[model samples]
Target: MPMPAQEIEELIRAGIPDAQVEITDLAGDGDHYSARVVAESFRGLPRVRQHQLVYEALGGRMGGALHALQLTTACPTEE
Candidate 1:
């Protein structure tokens, strides 16, 4: 089964409590998604590590239940 956007958002939020997550259905088919996550926890992490954290949040569903996800991450900019 394809993972729902809400589930994806919930997983990310669970992994990073302080994250601001936005999930978009790129292909309109529910299997492909784009997620933009912003969090203070990502502040010092490299982009690759940041993506890894999000992947961990998915709990090994990347190629199974969750087919494809285009993920982007960033730390909150200081005002």
Candidate 2:
């Protein structure tokens, strides 16, 4: 079975707590998704590390229940 977009967002939020997450089904299919995650905690992190955090939040589901994820991560803009 494929993962739901809401579940993905929820999982990210659960892991990042203060993150703002946006999930989109790029192919209109549950297996392919794109996620944008923004969090204050990512401020000083490298892009690779930021992506790792999001991957970790998925809890090893990357190749199983979830097929593909195009992820974008960033710190919240200073405003």
The lDDT leader among the candidates is: 1
Off by over 4 Å in 2: none
Model 1 stretches with alpha carbons more than 4 Å out: none
Compared with the true structure, what per-residue lDDT tens digits does model 1 show for residues 1-79?
Answer: 8889999999999998999999999999999999999999998889999999999998998999899999999999999
Model 2, span 1-79: residue lDDT tens = 9899999999999999999999999999799999999999999999999999999998999989999999999998887
Cα misplacement distance, residue 60 of candidate 1 (Å): 0.5
Question: TM-score per candidate, in order?
Answer: 0.97, 0.97
Model 2 lowest lDDT segment of ten: 70-79
lDDT of each: 0.95, 0.94
Residue-pair clash count for candidate 1: 0
